[model samples]
Target: MIAALRIPLMSLLAAAVLAGCGPNFAERSKTAEELTDEVIYQDRRRPPSRLRDVLFSRTDPAKVGGVNKYLWNASLEVLNFLPVQSVDPFTGTIVTGYGTPPGTGRAYRATILISDPALDARSLNLALQTRSGPVSVGTQRAVEDAIMTRARQLRDRDSRF
Candidate 1:
């Protein structure tokens, strides 16, 4: 009797542990989709000196709730949706190490040089500085802000996952 009970109890405990490990598959997928949307359809904004804060329902740090507030911070939002491994919000720059074709040389670090904000326009000067030359993300502030607003709504309304 004791041996049989032990087997059943162990199985139950194992089930509970797995259940508490992380969010379910659907939740994980949803989170991934959300992140991608933010990146691909990210707000097209001018370079900002500071990230503006949107009011979101307060969440307890001890609890798994609400959007990642840290991500919403001014600098982070600027570099949130770039095709890069990671970005540093401060100093207004982005570094990417993605490679070209298979036979291409080592991946280059592309720097997106963001300058100060301008009147009636946001300035995002992009300097690939490679064979491709430079590009600009300037004057897309309105689109970027709109997308950011929508993203905030998505997070604030649904607290799950």
Candidate 2:
């Protein structure tokens, strides 16, 4: 019947969508570690992050968790796929901001002072630059809070523990 056909069609669509979805957090974390190690650690020509030159080069990044991770990840989320040209670990400055333009309804900027290089890039400044939905302020805050909460959990679980 039509109902039977509809159900299968919907299920097939769902499966396709799910299959196309990317890796989750754990996978991303592993990939990031590998990439960082190869690019920043092994490649001596590249400037070293605190993590890269220190004893914890591999194990040390583990000491930071929660908002830090969220903060770092958020930078990557905002930056998305921009290539890097220059960097200074002492300060947080990405120089370039990527993603949708601000007028479209979503944007923000956060200038974070970074003391560690193991985090994402050293952007002495990060401006989210997105269009704000009708309720964007609260929603963004909520999202930031969730990131902080997750960060707190990460810090507690990984570093503090």
Candidate 3:
């Protein structure tokens, strides 16, 4: 009688333990499309995606973030007149202390942000400031255009290899 009860009790304990286990591997594993959908359409209540941050986060061996190298080089080349204060290649941001452009009496500072790896207009953002205050919109746009153009040229030049 005790042996019979022991078998039943053991079976009951096994079932209880197994019941707490989460879904099987097949159910837990998500397809690429499913993961993409879930990440893009995440609910407001949930915290921002740690996965997205990891995927896009810069882990380049040479730099801090995954910013476009071409754009970064081109930005420094184009704005070489200014004194660079800080640069984060991973995020593609270059901050200049202050320097007068050649042939200009006015002093100016610059902050360049290359947000994407693509050599495109939208990827480059330029903020220029004079001793007085922020520069005009036209000036900022012009700087952006110049950096993007230079970035494209750099990419083209590199691809020739």
Candidate 4:
């Protein structure tokens, strides 16, 4: 019947139209490699082309999440007794669960923040807490001072290289 023919004709017409929507591969155009290169180079947002460059490029240490690497490493080294709960290098924050220091009976937890790129006392923030409550200011300051001293030692050792 005409109605049955109309369905087939419409399908055929739709198929032809849809087929034309694809790229015309028969025409000469940029090859895959050329197209890829164009896309990569044309955009300024693209990362380095070589893996080695991306991995080993000499960038400013301060550019790493605005954190002093010495302070970060020092905090981890000094607080290695505590079990690390979470560490975000990008945010320059380290959180550790309760763990007693060597020769200490009471368990303590710590949160360290490296707020600046400078290897100075002001860049390191330390909060120590015991199961009872927050530790006294003197204890907090002592821990912070240890971290800063260690950070200086690390920087000094690195500078010798």
Candidate 5:
């Protein structure tokens, strides 16, 4: 009968279309098996991880959690008036002997600690001293502000490259 023939023909057409639509899971699994013997697969577990992982890793040789160079240099440059008693770049500490500023009669000393390499406000710690004892809060704050501003300027200048 014509109706029976049409039903079989439609079934055959549907099967053909579905087969050609795309590779099924079995075909995909077979392709993956074939690719397993490739060099890419062999090196998949190699060092340095995948590209995405390396992008997030810390790989910069110059950067450490220690003192920031910009802040260190800026501290020295800003506090050049004071006589440097000692400086340890490895430990990120600067101890200065008391000395009078050019326009002021007050003798001041400073102990600067660059705790971090980032040019952030918290990285630069300034301890100002006078002949009597620690200087006023306003004076300490003003000096800290000056050092932080200078440190930022230094960082910005270096970033241009």
Candidate 6:
């Protein structure tokens, strides 16, 4: 009689332990798609949790955030006359303060954005402004052309290496 009771008690204990394992009712009730969406939402909301994530996050192995090295160098070299306010190579932005060109009387400021890794005309954007207002489209085009020409020259020079 004691052996029979022991088996029943052991089975009851095993059932109680197994009941505590696995997902709770709320989690188990969600559909697979909902669960997946919830996971993605949580991941997006979460900030970098590790040092490696902070150091190399949003970086592509094939490029440096789509910035063209030739264009970047050429922009600085061509606009060296203007005082640099800020530069971010990762974002491919150069902001310059107002300064007269070598042969010009009027002061001008320039902001350059290199949006692509290609050394092409479309990859360079130049916003030129003077003390009164933005410069003419012709002037803007001229500066862009100069920067593009210099960028091509730089690329050609680098190829010799």
Best by TM-score: 4
Listed per model in order, the count of residue pairs whose N, CA or C atoms clash below 3 Å is 5, 19, 1, 0, 0, 0
- Candidate 4, superposed: residue stretches over 4 Å from native: 1-45, 51-58, 62-64
Which candidate leads in lDDT? 4
lDDT (10s digit) by residue, model 2, range 1-161 = 99879999999999999977966655535567677768766854444557647654544353233223444545445444444444443244444433343455344333334345343333223333343423356644564554445544555666555
lDDT of 6 by residue, 1-161 (tens): 99989999999999989988956876658788668878988655556779999998875432445698888989999999999999998889999999988877999999999998877888888999999999999999999999988888987887788
Better of 3 and 5 by TM-score: 3
What's the C-alpha lDDT at position 57 in model 6?
85
Better of 1 and 4 by TM-score: 4
Local accuracy of candidate 3 as per-residue lDDT tens digits, 47-86: 4479887577655422235677777888899899999899
Candidate 4 lDDT over residue span 1-161, tens digit each: 99989999999999999999988979988889778877877864456789998899887753456688888998999899999999998789999999999997999999988888887888788889999999999989889988888988988888888
Better of 3 and 6 by lDDT: 6
**Taking the tens digit of each residue's C-alpha lDDT, what string does model 1 give over 40-128?**
76885333334443334343432222223322332234434434765555444556544342454533234543344221114343333
Residue 52, candidate 2: C-alpha displacement in angstroms = 16
Superior candidate under TM-score, 1 versus 3: 3
Alpha-carbon local distance difference test for all models: 0.45, 0.47, 0.80, 0.87, 0.81, 0.86
Across 1-161, the per-residue lDDT of candidate 5 in tens digits comes to 99989999999999999898977766535466447656565754445658988788765433333677777888899899999989988778999998988898989999988887666888878889898998999999998888888877977787788
For candidate 5, list the clashing residue pairs, or say none. Answer: none
Report each candidate's C-alpha RMSD, comma-separated, in the order given: 19.5, 24.0, 11.0, 9.1, 11.7, 9.6
Better of 2 and 5 by lDDT: 5
User: By lDDT, highest first, what's the ranking?
Assistant: 4, 6, 5, 3, 2, 1
| Residue 88 local lDDT, model 6 | 90
- Model 3, poorest ten-residue lDDT window? 57-66
Q: lDDT value for candidate 2?
A: 0.47
Clashing pairs in 1: 43-144, 44-140, 44-144, 45-141, 51-74
Model 5 clash tally?
0
Misplaced by over 4 Å in model 6 are 1-65
